[model samples]
Target chain A: MTLSVALGPDTQEGTRTGTAEATDSLTAPDIPWNLVIWNDPVNLMSYVSYVFQSYFGYSESKANKLMMEVHRKGRSIVAHGSKEQVERHAVAMHGFGLWATVEKASGGPGGNSGKSGGPGQGKGKRG
Target chain B: MLQPEERAGQDPLAALIGLDMDVAEPTDRAVKRLLPNVVKDDGAASLEFRQLTERSLRETKIGALRAAALDLDKDEIVLTPEGAKHWSMALNDVRLVLAERLDIRDEEDAEHVHLMQDWSQAEDVESYLALVYNFATWLQESLVQAMLQSLETRR
Candidate 1:
């Protein structure tokens, strides 16, 4: 699956902050945002799992695990880092018949958002 | 109640794979059970809305989660989180049986019939349908609400 895109300055900041030794993140020092997938009714759990597998190329068990997380826990942070990059991810999820939103990673749960609400699909809290 | 196949005395496995009296009951029960939750209407949902979604849930492979390996029963299918989006789009639907087969007749129904016997109970249609009841696009939209609350947990 092509990850949702949420490209922005914050994502760059995060990359820079995380890996001083790494060029990819250090050169792009923005706080990474997250692409969160919330539970929904229309798509089947398996179908959602398939999108993660087929679209994202996640292994079958990994895909099912994510889908199960969404089902059992109500939501799962499928991807993290970079507002602009996460936003792109959000769009891709929407196209595939999944419910997705992008937000700045929270300092707490997601560990990817720079703050509680950064910038992307919605600036609200992670569900 | 539809007669429990007065003809299935031959193959127990075939009989098991085929829809039985057990299957027929849930068609009525599934629609009755899920319609209120899904449509939330006093008036009955249109036949078209009920039929299509029912068929879609039963027959469509769950492309997202890869759990379509479960052969769903009437009670097994309900609107998916995304398919629920069509509810408003299909407001014209008035009354639906929510059965897999379009025809009430047995032969056509038999073609679409899948045996619950081969399925995994943990991921059966019943559980999947339950998830469908809990799922909604609005649930996704409402994550903002959940986000705020989880933030409360942290603080």
Candidate 2:
């Protein structure tokens, strides 16, 4: 994918340092499914952000924002699209060795209210 | 468990080609981590999804690994962007498998493994594996940092 418009060097460098934390979650109104990247001990934070930037063509700052979310919050909904779109992204993420899962943006019956739930949802850190 | 070998029915070609039509959910936790359910808390749907997609996913990973291996034969390896991407993916996968074997389930476990730096201190299998894992992690991290720089330049 083509890279989007460039930001200042300072903006890119700020993301690389990664001290900033994103308070608001990423959201897409029309997209019905969410692709969530979960935190793991094995994956490097920089590698994870790089995947977000390269694979999805997210801006560096945006990618680092999501990566930090996963690092600090245990998980982050990094992408939103149709079921097929998100599922396809999930497979790509698995290919990259990142733990990812797709879910309906509108939580299903008996599912946790996804919007209100904290980042801890469905974070089953198994062996 | 996702046992392709047993299912390939003694056909070396089938096994070599990774042809398993009736693969089950992986019982091995490490394998499970590698090929996790796409949908959470829904095994039936996840299994169906896996049957449809897991084989190709495995092949994609294997292809990346093969590409990286081929590059290793050259005296001084130089990576095209595609080659670099494949190497990054290959190294990440290696780290994943090693982490599973090392039982690095959380940050604390990872730090414990990271402490195994000295080659002379490799007394047992686990410690040796930890060192390898740390090395892979370091290698991947450096590769990614370089990639990020490239991204910045292109931007």
Off by over 4 Å in 1: A1-31, A112-127, B1-155
Q: Which DockQ value does candidate 2 get?
A: 0.39
**Cα TM-score per model:** 0.33, 0.79
Interface RMSD, every prediction, one decimal place: 17.2, 7.7
Question: Can you write out model 1's per-residue Cα lDDT over B25-127, one digit (the tens) per residue?
Answer: 1345423322221111212222322232332332222232233223133455454534432331121111012221122223233222222222344376654
lDDT, candidate 2, A1-127, per-residue tens? 1011232122243535333333223333455567888888778777787899889998877787777777777788887776678878998999998999887666643122334543344334211
Q: Rate the local accuracy (lDDT) of all candidates.
A: 0.39, 0.74
Query: DockQ values for all predictions?
Result: 0.02, 0.39
| Candidate 1 per-residue C-alpha lDDT over A34-101 given as tens digits, one digit per residue, 9 for 90 to 100 | 56676632334434654675556665555666676676566777765665566555545644446565
Off by over 4 Å in 2: A1-30, A108-127, B1-21
Predicted candidate 2 versus true structure: per-residue lDDT over B43-148, tens digit per residue? 8667767766888788888899999999999999999989989999999888878888888888888878888899999999999998888788777777777888
Q: On a 0 to 100 scale, what is the lDDT of residue A62 in model 2?
A: 79
Best by TM-score: 2
Candidate 1 docking: what grade? Answer: incorrect
Candidate 2: TM of chain A? Answer: 0.64
